[model samples]
Target: MKKLLSILTLSLFVFTSCNDVIDIEQPGTLLAENAFKTVEDLQLGVSGIYNRLDNTTQIRFNSVYTDELAIGDDSGGQNVTQYSLFLTPTSGMAATLWNGSYITLNQINKILVAAESIPVATGEQADYNNAIAELKAIRAYIHFMLTTYFTTDYTDDSALGVIALSTIPGLNEDLPRNTNGEVFAMIDADLTAAAAGLSNQSSRTFISRDFITALRARMAAYRGQYTAADGYAATLMANYSIANQTQFFNMWSDTDDTEIIFELERNVGDTYDRQATGGGGWAGSLFAFVNSTASGSPFMEMSRSLYNQLDAVAGDVRLARYIDPSSTISATPTTSTDDYLVTRKYPGHQSQPLMNDIKLFRTAEMLFIRAEAAADANNLGGAATYIKQLRDARFGAAQPLPTYASQQEAFAAILAERRLELAFEGHRWVDIKRLGARANVSIDRDPIDCTVFNACSLSNSDHRFTMPIPLGAIDVDAALVQNPGY
Candidate 1:
């Protein structure tokens, strides 16, 4: 795949029309072709792929584009107004997600293609392969996320689609979307390779065997393959334990937390400054403000159902940690009604404080995946066990595990637990999408003219789910097709 990197880099230069300056170099040095020959070179090249996630264009803004959170009321007069789901094709959130994911995919593919030629006997060859495997897994993950948002049904089995470019050479080459099945197949293939290469290896918080296993479980669950999903999740949960509640919440603040399977770390100096202010800095400043009075921003109020769910469970520490009572903010003389109630997940830099680590995967989610998968496999008791394991830690040991009469009941509990646990982490939409198959809840956003309360009822059939392919992409490739209702 090393060759692929040079090809892609060269393609970028060619397409950008920079060939005129190619020959005006200074004294002789290692050519671009020979630069990545050593293990360190290969390791550095792979690191470049991991580094891309820190870019605001990719990681920071991309999460918001997913169903994690909408453009809160504060975005009424900002550059991100286009990001609201109520808006159409021009939404910055949608466009950034579409473009950024593809850019990362292209880079991953370049690494995958280039690393193939470098032999394992070379000092970096094994590490290079491992990095390539992780990158492939990450690329697959990105594709899976895009497919979830862009396609109506994965079970449709016949929906033709393309999610960015998976593996195409040359710059400005317009590519069509692959089918849902094709995309899923590609994702599965990549993950399978990742699992094999990453097995039993010790590495930092980039990717590991357990991480790939958890991802496999998640993908399988989405595909409705309950048995396989449950099995994979069970293995991981049994081998890797969930962190305690303090660790669960505090891990985000500590870059080297054991529970974090994969994370994008930020340093305290140059790296930190770059992430905080550079073009890559997409810390959801507006959303942060809305969620906290400390930031002097309005609050993105919680849905009535969500607020009630947390409130109904007495002594639920999550509610205290997750939601600040209206009175608490009201106590502050400067607080406005708009800032009365906001999510406590992200407390901004001034409140709970902000850390530079962007968590990619964690062990807590693995437990939830196990619970859901176990329920699907008719192991309601097992499902409840896993759910209570997490809940007991959060609520306290005195609280009894919520009992369920049947697998269906346990399934409902699992869903609710996911919502409460994973809120604002960008897993809500996918959970909704998967559950919508069994539950009556609709996944669509309301029309632009609708009021906020009424707007929440939009159906899963809403056109906004399948974001429009970027205008730039459509204009370049005649073969490219747009999603329906765009």
Candidate 2:
């Protein structure tokens, strides 16, 4: 039997009193004071943090709100439209992302700070530190992601920043956001410490040295630190071989694989019961696919440009894995729509549904990073070799390696390939941000405003790129500044 990864659940303690009218207070339990005292306590705290992973699957109501997938066309509820607005960012999705990410950050910070204070009497000291390192790594990971969504560019290291919470919860203070440079410095420090503490461990399914290195390379590439990025990415690619086309899809089910550096696991008893169950609550419906409930509103559809780009490539196995035609559509405006293709990549069903794990870092991504870095460093031949490895895997035994006339062409091809291969995996927006090419594509608006989709032009100057700090958060601390334009 496969071991089920534990998900954390906690009880909230509240106090209420009746005054002249009535005053009620619901004070949240602190992980520092209440949890993380022993191995079991620490385990539960860690589980709580990892439970967020469920949000990435189709089972949770909030799963696909990010760039991963659009609200299916059939959804009419306010939540669906509110989520759709997030894709373009004129609506409140930006605030939600900012708030939700910070919430996770808070949990990580508490875990790290608390874990450090607990004295280890046995060999558990090392285990405690390892757990601390894991939490810290998760903190850095969340920050890296938050910065990508909230800031304009990784190169702008000097901008005024949001608070970098490294300690446990206390009195709210007005801490200035660190510069992008400062933020990356913190991320690197956390990851380096995590790597050192986590080394010599044999758990391949959890976050490991390779995972940290891959993320470091990803951050380096985003910062245009080409040589460092290439070096780290090269180490990863050379050690862990790329997954074959079939293995690429199959590895999602296996959980333990050379390709996945870290992932989130789901099972029967632990399964999300939203859409997977017949219930109509948040977890009850599959938002990525079109259904009778969604009407004609496909929340997210592939852009014509992306669709054509994939169609232009022959014998690419990835296109099939990433997209599937909707056989259930009917003919009226309500149905019979061929445009309603569903993403099968994240299908998590009861038996064989979406048991496929959520990939954190994989060997193929590292190879692409190395290719881009090598190209930027003017090592065209080296860049070409790496690019061919990835392309050939997708094209298989029949197709010949593509030829590029110039370094720029090879670079562009590599990027395009990343976009196609990594779509809906929470990567496209970051890639566009790092490249400073926000102006290149038009934004797709909600389906109700069909004209908005045609007219939504995006530019680097658009304020939408930087999300507004959450209203609730701002209300809590007057000193906390909102992102400019939000």
Candidate 3:
């Protein structure tokens, strides 16, 4: 593990400062020809690729930049600029998102290229094919994230999307951004090829057929294809059961995977053991310097608005699962420092503080997707039923089913439910960006939380909703067009 981390750390430094949009420099230890000589070698290479995948950047950007979190007492100007609605082409988060994703994509492309030349033995063919399928699945997922964050409009096919890199680019090749239509076409092709080669697997830590389904479900929902999203989500809902209160609590402790569909496993002394500023870090470290506690130097706390919403629920287990037990919740949090509201969502696992697995997909998200689809189709009652079904599991008892009079009301209810359910899992920002205008809502930080910077709200239609193309990439290639209003 130490040796692999050393190689990856060095490789990441090279990848981050490359002149090309997607550069490939071989790691010092493993050359492509010698890396994939056998099925075992291919499997090892895939594991290394998986190490490059982390959502800490998205989680941090979503929480601190949105209404999910507020500046904590321990803050020393960390993310203060972003929390103040200050984003630019040179913003650290933008550059991190662009460079980190392309790095992972390049790694996958490199492995795929090397695997093409491998000699498959009769008995090893299945393993070889499965390895390749997993690579394709991860590639498609990275591209999906890139498109979701970088593209200005998900509904417009002609809108600018990120560069689609299926193969490693030459050192001097400067790639231009592709259209949303082109990127989605590439994603669909990769997913289709992945689905054909993958087989059933029981592990939630690795890519399975269900992972592909979950990705399709999310992509469809983002693209506003309600029918397709509904079908994909329903298949997964039937396969995986939602977690009850006890199961949900255990899930945060890494004691259960009852509701999780896929997560990136983080182990002690692995590639992501330490603090990483942008992409690779413990998800908990994004909020706190040491751990998820008041004394642990938590630089960010759960927003009072979000906490109040959870507290309003009579018996919802998410409130306990999200906030630390040791926190001091003030009756009236008139200021950010009045209440600790320490976040305990990633309390840590395997006796490592703040190092839990990065959960990418869960059955709960699928339920939300179904609810959104129902609302979009004007099946208000059906949408309410799905939301109530989830609430019943969380409260560990039957709850009153909600009612919506209009389609916008149904959408508003669905988005509200999603905000609470998917709180710290990196969905809040994108949720509002895509569904906010439809639901007639946007970022509304509590008066108390935003008093420090006076950045209490952002309109749904604001151009800042779409992240700007990072200046680092643009500086490298002048021809690459930037997102509008950046």
Q: Which predicted model would earn the best lDDT?
A: 3
lDDT of 3 at 207: 88
- Quick one: how many clashes does candidate 1 have? 14
Candidate 1 RMSD computed on C-alpha atoms after optimal superposition onto the true structure: 5.9
In model 3, the number of clashes is 0
CA lDDT of every candidate = 0.57, 0.57, 0.85
TM-score of every model?
A: 0.78, 0.78, 0.93
Leading candidate by TM-score: 3
- Ranked by lDDT from best down, the candidates are 3, 1, 2
- Runs in model 1 deviating more than 4 A are 1-35, 54-84, 116-122, 163-166, 170-174, 199-204, 255-258, 270-286, 289-305, 324-339, 342-344, 347-353, 378-381, 403-410, 443-454
What digit string (tens of lDDT, one per residue) describes model 3 on residues 1-486?
122223433363233321232233444544566456677777877776676788988888888888999998888988899999999998998888887777778778877887888888888878888889999999999999999898998989999999988876665567889899999999999999988888655459888989999999999999999899999999998889999999999998999999899999988988788785765878888788888887899888999989998999678999988988878889976777789989989999888899999899999999999999999998999999999999999999999989999988988888888889889889888999999999998999999899779899999898898999888788776558988898
Off by over 4 Å in 2: 1-31, 54-92, 199-204, 252-258, 271-286, 289-301, 325-338, 349-355, 398-400, 403-408, 436-452
lDDT of 1 by residue, 47-148 (tens): 665555653443333234333343344444443332344546565556666665666676566555555565567455566667667777788778877776
lDDT of 3 at 329: 89
lDDT of 2 by residue, 1-486 (tens): 000000111221110111111112225533355545575566556656655543332222222332334434454553444343344333444544555566667667756666666667776766666777777788888888767666666767887555676753344344456778888888888998898777434344566777788788888888888889888888877777877778765564453376765655555554343343221112223443323122423444444445456668677776676555542332223221334545555545345443345566778888888887777777777777877788777777545556666666766677677767776555654554454352233233233223332332345345655556666556556566667666
